[model samples]
Target: MREFLVEITTTVPEGTGQEEVDRRRSAEAARAAELAATGNLARLWRPVGELRSIGVWRATDEEELHEKVLGTLPLRPWMTLTVTPLESHPNDPGRLDASR
Candidate 1:
């Protein structure tokens, strides 16, 4: 598996109902939990003062990351995602700790 950093920005359409937004948000949360249970989702964080999230995710490849994992999001239509593939660094603390 490969790790990726994904930044997601959400934009609700103009005039969309509050109930619909709530429903989608709930569904999105449920989906995120499912992904986490399966180890596809590693970590998530929200940037201060932004309607965006940054997350670490695992997948076989970029295509799978997009199509299979992220594509399953209920709020995908309203989200813009930027994905960055991660490579292990020799001096990464996590790697060093694992080696020990």
Candidate 2:
């Protein structure tokens, strides 16, 4: 299956507290674990450098990748979901393809 990067963006409603955000994060983690159980999950990580955001790599087709990301988020009125294909790379690039 093709691998994709699923992006989960949350926009909390007005008057929301830190507790609610934590709760949503917890629920999202649980859902991610469920996805990981199956072959759909490739890897989960966060961005580095100046930007920071949780990233989940999932194996899915074009039509279903974004749909799968929806399951990773909580029920919120202002949440935005996005999915994009991830470029495949070797674990040890230095050891292979020395002809680069």
The lDDT per prediction is 0.95, 0.62
State every prediction's TM-score relative to the real structure.
0.93, 0.58
Per-residue lDDT of 12 in model 2:
71
By TM-score, how accurate is candidate 2?
0.58
lDDT tens per residue, model 1, 5-49: 999999999999999999999999999999999999999999999
Per-residue lDDT of model 2, residues 1-100, tens digit only: 7777666555677898989878877887777677777766657655565222455555557666555544444643455656677654655464446453
Name model 1 segments beyond 4 Å from true.
96-100
After superposing candidate 2 on the true structure, give the runs of residues whose Cα lies further than 4 Å from its correct spot.
Answer: 7-9, 49-51, 54-56, 75-82, 86-100
Among these predictions, the greatest lDDT belongs to 1
Q: lDDT at 29 for candidate 1?
A: 96
